[model samples]
Target: MQLTVFPAPTSPTANLDHGHDHGGCRTKALQTAEQLCNNRGVRLTPMRRQVLELIWESHRAIKAYDLLDRIKPTTGTAKPATVYRALDFLLEQGLIHKVESLNAFIGCSFSDHQHQQLLLTCIRCLEVEERPAAGVMEAIDRELEQAAFIIHHKAIEIHGICIRCAKHPPITATI
Candidate 1:
């Protein structure tokens, strides 16, 4: 098989790191979702909104079944399909991101804007933080271009101890 290379883009412009009001993140995300859906002529259905809220309940990535379990109590009987559909809608609207490796979902930090960034998962805390490294994305673009390849969807996941976790000792299981 032959290899290919591509040309990349520019420098790093933003950092989605932690250290702010998490509630603010959720509020902004919901507001942004509302505005974007309205602007795009799409409806921010109740189910989708609920899913977005649950995902934004924390910075950690959560799985589909977990979402279903959480919603069933509130909805009185949430089907797998309903939760999945809501997740699909949120993902399509860029309100949330699917952590491919973990098969879980996390609210996107750059939801208001359009751009894919790095997902840093804290092994100890299980919190996933978004970091927009334009420099790194540029390099990926360059590599893809050199190979004459078209991009479909992309996500870079890095798993390790986050700053908070790194500062503290590892979390041990109760059992």
Candidate 2:
């Protein structure tokens, strides 16, 4: 028998269904990352910056190899290890998040500060929206305390149909 465990459900509704200014969001995230890296005395190398840019290009979770392939056109002879190293650096600096469930990465806007969050992935569009679920995280912490458990890491990924998709699904052509 196999056992599968899923994270607890998050907030009931989607908050990013409306028009999203991805241009502004991308700029802000890159600026914040640069500032954080500068403050921490860390180098946001060109490769790392590129990786972060790719992650922020869409709301969807992206795998490392996908990053590698996407980067190859601009960066010649890019290797998996090189991308992984950049990913490690980004993860260490909290500039990006690794969505374990999807085995992918996503940029974090609140990387400058420490906070618990949950990712709401749209099943239809495959877009991932990050939401700060303080209440849910607090409840989890309480449960952990009661269980006398120590948390080394924390992240919650909830998969469902986003409001945008639910409200206005893509029109399919008749066969």
Candidate 3:
């Protein structure tokens, strides 16, 4: 078997790392966005940045309707298609990922390149956790080998009650 070698671009943001630091996260994401758009000769419009920022603030999968709600007043009663187009651009740039199960999206926690999004949804608090599935990804590679399948982007999502919810049950049974 032979391996392919790809040349690297001259953008600095391509080396950013993904972690739980929001300060670093936002700064890095913005810088990365600029680098990516500039490298591709595309404009990352202000409105697009605003929409992406809202999604990042939540750190969870957000529905299109939800995004529309947040962007409406500022964007002057935004239409669904408009928001969808912005989302499409973001996804195309690998800046975000759509959660298939929830019909929602979250900011791509990875910085340098588009990384596989792995979500851990809390059944009780409805909080979504994003992390790199290094170990699980390796396991999937082995499993796929056993089945003679080639896996592309690794998506391993698990839904369950979080520790806080497990210890303290909600009174109203909210999601």
Candidate 4:
């Protein structure tokens, strides 16, 4: 999966949600995170930040179940509701987005900006990633016009095995 571990310049800065952050990147993301939370009048509780951080740490999209496993405390365990609520809040704020096909979520790289997103999922590996497809919207518009239909916000996603998967068999079979 293409993780793009670091945030791009054009996107609203957020703490990396994946593996680990070093140097100034983490600081910038944390600052941005605080600002966003303040502006939205939402509390960035410890649990919430931890969840978001875990998502940022990996460049790849993460399933909620996997995330729960990652974030479960060493001493005790977190309940499903805990992870679900944090994810729900993050999604509501547009700080992250869900890839319906993969049943996974990724940090919103462009949280501070406005744009539509399209996801490309690797079917075999089940990796989820996104790219901006402004032109695709125009094509979609044409298709929709032919159907004489109106559309709401659209999240166009394609699912298939990626080149990596095609070249190298995964250790485990796909579900």
Candidate 5:
């Protein structure tokens, strides 16, 4: 499936809503995960589903520790290992991407694994937006090919302030 990439708003005051359906987006991600697991003959356990849901519930990237903390209240016995294992599974299945700089995980907006993606991270809000980076990948591949190198896994992260955060800076406290 092809995912449409939305360009950044040209004006600061633009509504910025490109017809995104939040609830539907979450549901679609879950459904895509389930379908992927089924196709691979792997089971998406209840714990995995719960973890995926938690990650999709927020647009911001989430650390594994934060996931464990959130799960603890519901499971009453959640552990870091449990969350990590779930994250590993999701990562292996390409259902999520790990942001190395932030040490956090974000649900993959695209289901296809044929291409690499570039993540735009907001330094202030810690929110992440994914955009297809086919051109970037192609350039990397060309350079790697010249060097006789191969890429097994790839994710590029660009740090910047999102338009929303740029337009309205976060409030600061005065001592």
Candidate 6:
């Protein structure tokens, strides 16, 4: 099976930062999640809302344990199972994606559309940018048909240094 990988630009002017109105994005995402749950006859619980809010706080991939830590203050008795359950719910509803390479989760920028996820992860800064890989699903389906393979889940992560990191490396302390 042939997979097309797009390289992130290394130029200084390349908009490596996935710029979005943070507050607006979060509001829209929460609204979308609520609508999706309502339409599917599922409840968007308070804990789920908290978890989604934490995930949308940044565009970077966040680990489950980290989420658990963050939610502890509010939900004093929060546990791993609780976070995992919320994460699973979000994933099922297409509200978030798991970054396989980083073993972390990121909020889906385009949750309304059904498409294969193409993630660009920065190795240095750990920033993740998601884009839709059109035709990728069809291509994979065609290949799977030829090989008689059944698919379960799919996540595509492309790792490379981001433009900011490339332009300015972290300064090391010299003795």
Q: All candidates' lDDT scores?
A: 0.81, 0.81, 0.71, 0.69, 0.80, 0.81
Q: Write the per-residue lDDT of candidate 2 for residues 58-154, one digit (tens) a residue.
A: 6777899998988899988999998999999999998888888999988886887865588888877677888887889889999999999999998
The regions of model 3 sitting more than 4 angstroms off are: 1-24, 167-175
Q: Which stretches of candidate 5 lie above 4 Å from their native place?
A: 1-21, 113-115, 169-175
> In candidate 1, residue 117 scores what lDDT?
89
TM match of model 4 to true structure: 0.68
Clashes of each: 10, 0, 0, 11, 0, 0
- Which whole-number lDDT from 0 to 100 does residue 146 have in model 4? 100
Worst 10 residues of 6 by lDDT: 7-16
**Global lDDT of model 3:** 0.71
- Model 3, residue 99: C-alpha shift (Å): 1.3
Q: Show model 1 residue runs off by greater than 4 Å.
A: 1-20, 171-175
What's model 1's TM-score?
Answer: 0.84
| Candidate 1 residue-wise lDDT, 69-168, digit = tens | 8899898989999999999998888889899999999998888775688999986667888988989999999999999999998889999978876675
Could you estimate the TM-score for every candidate?
0.84, 0.85, 0.73, 0.68, 0.82, 0.80
Off by over 4 Å in 6: 1-20, 167-175
Candidate 6 has a TM-score of: 0.80
What ranges in model 4 sit over 4 Å off?
Answer: 1-30, 123-127, 145-148, 160-175
The Cα RMSD of model 2 versus the native structure comes to 7.7
Q: Which digits, one per residue and each the tens of the lDDT, describe model 6 over residues 51-169?
A: 99888777778899999999999979999999999999999889999998888998988888764578999876667888776777678789989999988877778999777667765
